[model samples]
Target: MNKTNRKKFYDSQTWKSCRKLVLKRDNYLCQLSIKQNKLTPADIVHHIEHFEDNPSRALDMDNLLSVCSSCHNKEHPEKGRKKDKRRMKSRRMMI
Candidate 1:
């Protein structure tokens, strides 16, 4: 999708509700590192999976995460596999 459309999609009401649920579920803490870092309310809601795969999932609290921008950036690796893979790897390591 084009940048404009992508921006619109990201800024839609669905995203807004999804983000709100994530923030509420996590109590506004960054779930990635579980850090209570200060951040704008807008910066808290992050997608656990790509929006393309399941945009509807964004609305599901189970599929959302509260994260600061820094950790979110690290979670979303631009050069390698996407954030979801990294999260799975981390989960496997934990187990």
Candidate 2:
């Protein structure tokens, strides 16, 4: 999605509720990390399929994923929030 549409979608009540549901369903844990045998706290709800490419599944629960800042950035490098190489390791909770 374009920046304007993306912002509006994120700011909507529908997305707010959907995000909460996805987080709860995933137990607030990063789903990708779990698949790798690492447990991490999830702080963002990500689209498994890019909403920009497939608008029809924008609000589909099956297309949503609970992820952490690190994982989300990995999935969307265009976000330009790549981890700082000079910074210390993140202190995000892990199990």
Candidate 3:
């Protein structure tokens, strides 16, 4: 889907309700945090199968994971790492 359509889907009641259900199912705790024996509150419901790759599974509970921002970034680091690399290169140039 295009950006507008994707945004509309995310803003829809269906997605909101599903997001809440996923968060509740995960007990509002980050699954990654729980695995590491932490108790961080989740702020994102991530798509395990990636919505971009499988839009049909976007609202699938089984394909969702409650996660904190840190865990979410770690899970999807392509954008984050590229930005970080750019920043590092810029810093090196400055130095």
Top-lDDT candidate index = 3
TM-score of 3: 0.89
Residues 1-95, candidate 3: write the lDDT tens digits: 78998899899999999999999999999999999999999999999998889999999999999999999999998866978999999999999
What is the per-residue lDDT of model 1 for residues 1-95, given as tens digits with 9 covering 90 to 100? Answer: 45686689779997777677777777776766655545433366767776656766756677778887777777777735576788999999999
**What ranking of all candidate models by lDDT puts the best one first?**
3, 2, 1
* Backbone clashes, each candidate: 0, 1, 0
Better of 1 and 2 by lDDT: 2
lDDT tens readout by residue for model 2, 1-95: 68999899989999999999999999999998999999999999999899999988989999999998889989987764455532334543331
Q: What is the Å distance of residue 35 in model 2 from its true position?
A: 1.0
Best to worst by TM-score, what's the order? 3, 2, 1
In model 3, the Cα lDDT at residue 25 comes to 96
RMSD of 2: 6.5
Per-model C-alpha lDDT, please?
Answer: 0.70, 0.89, 0.95
TM-score of 1: 0.61
Report RMSD for candidate 1. Answer: 9.0
